[model samples]
Target: MATSYDYVIVGAGSAGCVLANRLSSDPGVRVLLIEAGGRDNHLIVQMPAAAPIAARDPRLDWAYVTEPEVFCENRHIIEHRGKVLGGSSSINGMVANRGNPRDYDAWAAEGLPTWSFAHCLPYFKKMETFVGGANEWRGGDGPQSIERCPATHPLYRAFLEAGVEAGYERTEDQNGARHEGFHIAQSFTRKGRRCSSAAAYLHPVSHRANLTVLSRTLTRRIVFDGRRAVGVEAQTGGTISTYEASREVILSAGAINSPQLLLLSGVGSAAQLRSHDIAVVADLPAVGRHLEDHQIVPIQYSTPEGLSLSHRLKGLRRYGIGLRWLLFKSGLGASTMCEAGCFFRSSDRADYADIQHEFYPLTAEMGDPEANFDDGFMFSMGLMRPESRGHVTLKSADPSEHPAIVFNYFAAERDRRIMIDGMRRTREMAAQRAFDGLRRAEIAPGPDIQSDDEIMAWLRSAASTEYHPCSSCRMGVGEDSVTDGEGRVHETEGLRVVDASIMPHNVTANLNAPVVMLAEKLADAIRGKTPLPPSGLVPH
Candidate 1:
């Protein structure tokens, strides 16, 4: 690696990898992409059913346990994040969801100009290469290959039929004109491997002479010149050192680490920074505040008889499946367990209803739900439009110290009320007569658990994260905003943040696609080239 580069990106996660690829395309610009872990070329990291095992395996994961919560099953929940070259995308269920169109509109409504669905859709199309082929809505030739999940599991098919029988309409494309009702989920799988950001953006370009890819490096903090971010200090190969950005320092770290890095670098609230003896650099109060995450309360039920991956774990059978995955890359090892999912509204939902009902066809046994699974389908229902807010605060000035995360989940009465309605709605759909042929019995909250109080009790005892945490470093038009709509950190000349942390609010679905889209747009902005918008509209 050179002593300096045009762009020094921290954390080779979803967004970072994309930025590294897009920004380095200039050939003239030298880019440095640093990661905290090694390559994402592992077999477990590519296969889908292996995601659970990969999530639990500390060698490839940063298994973070949440602070004790008042409503989370009355215990601290364990959260898993990938620490490899592709970050969470290396270990996450490879669902390629862009959330609802209304999600981006909400950001525009919050004074972030150019963030509307109409504005960002081009970036989405630019980064994707949909396997089913694209029309006007889907992108045909892009980097990420999005395809429909194979019709392998019988229970997933049953779930779709049940939704249709329960008075719901069939939506062909969730990322198209509308995002509602039941449908088979699209995934980021090219052939049999997960098309993570690294695979899609980094792997092909790893040989670029102008680009330097460093692994097993832990960034301690952003080194600053006055209030401007000049570079970063990190530990590589157990040796402490610093890397200069020369032109710009972008923090593409995920929501958790982005905020933690800001706080550790004395770029947060004056009061909080001073408490830890940190000399304040920039008093950005919203640096670690306004944290939001999607909470899922699973509704499980047994299937009478179907190929549900439940019996596959018995004795030598699982090993056989593993052998097939390692050799042929087919069978249960090729894709994620959730073959199909739906987005529907509570009967009384008002403004938008597409932010609920994300079902998965599996059940687990531990704190991180993926770690403990036996057999059954689970419908994870919650308020996709949560009003609750939380934050990531420093425990001390030490970068290695665990940050204090107060999710304050279900703290708002509105959050609780919406979740209660959401649960009722899911159960109502699951009880449809179409499922009568496939489903055996309700395993959780059961047929006897009926009442708002009962549902809330179950939520308080069972709710967990959907693994989408964002908006800790929110973008806005006001002074309180951490970055501008273009992702430029306000007042910082060369620094920018192109990750989920820049999202003003949580998208109504999975966030990986949107994060990649942000990087694509930011690349255009940095290169001073205006790519064609989805509708061919030019700014006045």
Candidate 2:
């Protein structure tokens, strides 16, 4: 007989891990969590500094590449999605940013009243235990642990000081009442170890008898009776199996996979499904539309010698740092390299920050080992809210085939203008007196690329994703929306999406923290628990 579960969550990613822990807490409920990849127990995942390595590790990352993008000079950008137990949370840079509250208010205005910043704030607090103590804006005790980066390095300090010197405000906590300024980053780390969702939520509850976590299980399709999803057909190792979901089958498979799964199960555009020779169940045209991501162009500089993390990569020192982290979980290995960042408006006309910046202490050619060096620092300027839209479509009917993704970045004239302004602003920050002694020369876009046209040309060739993708199965009120306000598929029962895909639009910051909060909010709705009372704090 097929194993029966009260809840079956596909894709043990950020949202799936949280759902497994929260839903199975009742003891009476049986929860099955399926992951396409294996456990996240490797040291590369445990150490915060090893995130970049984990992102490229085939065993840990799906490493999906995009289709050629016209706005990006027809180049295919590599998109890394974590395949391990904790999903992208295990492989990401660990920056825990909640984004601007207004971003959520904008969602509320778009017909998702329950998702406003006022309503979602409590859930954000419910999922995190911030190290700086709790306040009206921060959470105190929660499953996920977060620590503020010390920004102790002179380079980090210079970066923050330079932001202020450039006339930007200095916010103590970006996740607090105000986020429009320069601030030290907060990370998903505790005691110097990466606190991935698997580590924080799933690992702690794995002993629960009613909870079953199936690693290396690839969900092929949703098994539906009539129009209601009743179970999932999946493949484990060399065998194909069916698992019954007595109550609900939540698709927390993320932005790319969730919509793909829905489309593959005969739930997408009628014409598209017919092309693949699949019978249509629900013809939702927006299943894979509205794809959004933060596009970033890096600004690297060859800093004065010995100022970056380059020295740590040298011969014996590399092994020594590894030993220190493996033994005491300290030293350079304990940090996520990206220690400081800022959010600011690109122009005076904007009411809030539309540009975000990240500072990296070490500089190395990501994939080219021969170009790896030890004495440079870099920062990336990312547009917070891009107007350009994109889509994700099935490459074929095969579930094993990755979807074709195209993020038409810079397609909107406003987007291009903002990016250009962002580049100019980044140059201003780097030129600040705070970096006067350390700054050597600009490595990317060089000093020669000065005009607006030159910067636009450079961006078309060099811009890349910040790796935050969402809104493929966007939640809204119309026919174009795949899911409703609470994540229920508009015309389907017994199915829901509880990941970044449900975001009506991408938030102003990193997607990880918001994704986790989405799961927490949805779990309450599923359990029939009363919604937490809004704190009534006005949105900033």
My TM-score estimates for the predictions, one after another, are 0.96, 0.98
Q: Tell me the spans in candidate 1 whose CA falls farther than 4 Å from its real position.
A: 305-307, 534-540
TM-score of predicted structure 1: 0.96
Who wins the lDDT comparison? Answer: 2
Q: Specify the poorest-scoring 10-residue window by lDDT in model 2.
A: 364-373
lDDT of each: 0.80, 0.90
**Cα error of candidate 2 at position 14, Å:** 0.6
Show where candidate 2 strays beyond 4 Å: 365-374
Cα lDDT for residue 18, model 1?
A: 91
Model 1 lDDT on a 0 to 1 scale:
0.80
- lDDT tens per residue, model 2, 118-151: 8999999999999999889888999999999888
lDDT tens readout by residue for model 1, 110-184: 886688888888888889998778776789989888888875576777778888888877778787766877878
